[model samples]
Target: MTTTATAAPGAHLPEHLDFLWRSPEPEKAYDVVIVGGGGHGLATAHYLARNHGITNVAVLEKGWLAGGNMARNTTLIRSNYLWDESAGIYEHALKLWEGLEEDLGYPILFSQRGVLNLAHTEQDVRDSVRRVEANKLNGIDAEWLGPDEVAKVCPIVNVSSDIRYPVQGATYQPRAGIAKHDYVAWGFARRADEAGIDLIQHCEVTGFHVGGRDGDSVTTVRTTRGDIACGTLALCAAGHSSTLLDQLGIAAPLQSHPLQALVSELLEPVHPTIVMSNAVHVYVSQAHKGELVMGAGVDSYVGYGQRGAFHVIERQMAAAVELFPVFARAHLLRSWAGVVDVTPDASPIVGRTPYDNVFLNCGWGTGGFKATPGLGWAFADTVAHGRPHPLIAPFGLDRFVTGALVDEHGAAAVAH
Candidate 1:
């Protein structure tokens, strides 16, 4: 909660430090109130201050900063989605990620080594080719790699046909890679704070006072801290999106499930680019600190617990060893899970609600971390202009009712 002021050149000040202060207490009213202080909400607040000149904004969090799903994700980022709508939004995020460090003046350990989605069956190859073609058509970089090319790109992967899900080919995106998830969240939080955005942690929203000329709009948000009035309220509560919306008598088409991930004991780099296999149901990537970060599908049932069943991790490890036999010997360092709010079509819901000046950005599912900056940029525009950005307009809640969902389950493989 404190930043040390760095010493000026040859001046008397703390070196490599900045001024420190406690987060301000919430005011009676803010121009805007954002629920959840995760990367998306923090980014949205930053953009509202930087782009829209909305400095009187407050971001409320139920826990300490970035203590929710933002801290629980495996930081894999990519934008090689199959659909144009999905591609557009994620690609915008990718571009923002490419320059995030410089923009935030914070090192997020951004690395664009590459990412490869392996193909195990003939149908997998066909789908990979189709997706690659679509990605190229949309101006997103993607290529289909044969077994030999896939092996060359990631030598540690077992490409032999002897395995259960042998590598037949793969879809490769050179721009895809991982970043420091915590750093990204903190960087945005720090910048948002500098922009005069109130980051009120431990301030859980309890309810809202709905009143307007039409008698259906949120005039004030009742929180653990106290009720605060706002002209507009944006919800970015991720897994708890439904819980928060229910307080307003609004129901979102979101199903919450636990998605787990684990990191192996640190070792010398053996894995190269990020490797994934929908057929085997595991994805592996090495973190900046040398731990093998791995993840797979979510649990079948719905749950609010932030931890998942042990068998799910066991199965994922079994699949990981099947693909990379070397990983069988690696000891698990730690494991955790994040509750994700998934939509039926595997796409995000970003748009206005039934009530005036009440916006919702949820149902990002497993791929929310990768879309942080883009969501912030677009959602900020949405809240500022009172309409969604064109990139996210198609992902509105109406898509579910109108049956225009953009299904990307295949592209968002391994629960991100």
Candidate 2:
């Protein structure tokens, strides 16, 4: 493990991050095997070593580390959901995000610039206010701000009544903000690597060998690199989770969709706070580098493609211009997409699978990046004890059949 100097507060990030984690060859077997090297998997591995003292672990990534959704997300972090179950997990993650920099001994560039989920219609106002009350009951900081107050938070937004979807109000979370996605991934990777965990790249898991008496447990994971035996297997593959679950003959109701996001050319910082409008179907925030980081709902169609349809981008920009009139002249820099695994209720599925010693952590959709630290903490405990953590117990696979789903479609504010 190498020790890199932490940047001063509000200082510019290094042009190039020094090699923080070692690239080690995958061993034939390990105590725990995580199938994705994204933020979630890396965080889980870090907590597995830090909390449980479990160091013999391997994180298998088909591509480069954090090159997947970890790099493609819009980088918004908030926990103002409308349900108790949703609030529990997300708020926990927000608390973890508040202290992540010092905990990782790395500069994550986490900014608590606050977030405002705008309401454009009467119904939007009703829903936003209701969610604000729910967040308050959950002990989360939330406030319902009128259009004028919304303007005070973000002056550039087009809040006049003349617009098609005029701002009625918004739900504001003062603690919510964004972080540097790449830095968050690298921070977790460095810590996990320091704990003697093997972070293996270009190692794709192709199949699974279930060899218990009743064929109820996975004994070995067959990867592109080679087969590796494991005592416990955890799937944190995000959009590609179904591909690996298919090898184990598990039928999970997961749909993979292309979630697109784009950034504008670097300019003077005009946006002061993060603004999101589910009615307009777009969200925008100013990054540390002065780029306007923006994104919208996922593509309607299901596919594994990393790039999204042009129509989605066109609609996203149209929505952005309508919400923020000043953004009309902003030059489009570049765009990219990530495959997100969505569930029927727009909530994640975490906990034990039908197979013994096999854990599942997917279906996070667009909210995965925000839930990195909290999910990692809970999932690591789940894997260590071979049981569902209380925080994630409500999101088990049985919810679909038992009619106990944590439906977040309407409350999620965005098509997660």
lDDT of 1 by residue, 1-416 (tens): 11111111232213332332136799999989999888899999988988899989999887766777888899899998888999899999999999999999988999898999988888888778888998999999998899999889998889888877779989899999999987898788888888888988778788889899888689999987998999999999988888887778887788888899999999998888899889888889999989999998778998777776789988989999988888879999999888889998889999999998999999999899999999999999999999989999999999878989888775533336
Candidate 2 wrong stretches, greater than 4 Å: 1-18
* lDDT per residue as tens, model 2, 273-334: 99998878899999999999989988899888788678889999999999988889999999
Error of 2 at 203 (Å): 0.5
TM-score of each: 0.94, 0.95
Question: Residue 354: error of model 1 in Å?
Answer: 0.5
Q: Over all chains combined, what TM-score does candidate 2 have?
A: 0.95
How high is the lDDT of residue 195 in model 1?
81
RMSD of each: 6.2, 5.6
Question: What TM-score does prediction 1 earn?
Answer: 0.94
lDDT (0 to 1) per candidate: 0.86, 0.89
